[model samples]
Target: MLILTHTLYLNRPEGEIPIAIRIYRPEPKDGCWACTFEIDWPEGTKTMSGAGLDALQALVISLQMIGIQIYTSTYHHDGALRAYDNEEGYGFPIARNVRDLLVGADKIYL
Candidate 1:
């Protein structure tokens, strides 16, 4: 089991909210592995279960719950960038590179 806590900042209400994510795999039954997660936030909490969900998927679900959207695009067929946008029409500048984008993303999603 892995547990992580993060703080998400919102522009709509202009405040910070705490979020907790937990990921674990239950004992295999009939030789299949499944991933389960729980998300805790200021407003409410949610739990999900699935098969073969990776770390990125888990983070995406948590971010979606808090109303943040992530977009990725490739430029000129040479490089890639990511954008972080919220429901209130607020967006972060396009990241210079994937590494830079992941660094910013880790703060909110990890």
Candidate 2:
């Protein structure tokens, strides 16, 4: 799997959450092209939570609408990038095919 990254900075709010996103892309030649979205928080922030997975799950739903089969990594205590005291986490997973994986009803929590 060849991994690539695309980062995004947000200056506005989406829904009731004030979140920023970073999108990472997998190598195009691979069977599937995958992406990761991360949330950015500012200094002194202490109550922002659940945005990452929620965003990821939402993305999966959106991808499924178009036909994308994707894979998400499992949740590892040590795998979280922006670690919190069980309040938040990070996941990096691959989508085997862009459209096929998104057709399931299971939640991909990584």
Candidate 3:
């Protein structure tokens, strides 16, 4: 089951490109929840997964892996979906508190 979907814009030499990110619902297995994140790139589709204690953790670990890949690769940090001119820059507004979800050092599940 799909849990979430996001469209990330990438800036290329020619123009901006849209990339698809899909996250699936976590499933319980072996004392943990397994989650999947799919990235639909122009070349092909790539899927990465991770396991955690709960649904949110699963999503976090899964997304962290994906985020690392995005930041390191050529497809990241170049485009903006909604235009804004601010020194602070654009930020995602989360309705819920995410302080508890933060993991430091080796705590991130690979």
Off by over 4 Å in 2: 1-18, 28-30, 41-110
Candidate scoring better on TM-score of 1 and 3 = 3
Q: Pick the candidate with the highest lDDT.
A: 3
**Tens-digit lDDT string for candidate 1 (3-41):** 443333322345433445555544343444445556563
Error of 3 at 25 (Å): 0.8
Cα-based TM-score, every candidate: 0.37, 0.20, 0.63
Task: TM-score winner between 2 and 3, please give it.
Answer: 3
How much lDDT does each candidate structure score?
0.39, 0.30, 0.60
TM-score ranking of the models = 3, 1, 2
The digit string of per-residue lDDT tens for model 3 on 1-110 reads 99878766655668777778788998897898989888777788898887899988887778766655554445433333311223221122211233232223212322
Worst 10 residues of 3 by lDDT: 87-96
Q: What is the C-alpha RMSD of each candidate to the true structure, in Å?
A: 10.5, 14.1, 8.0
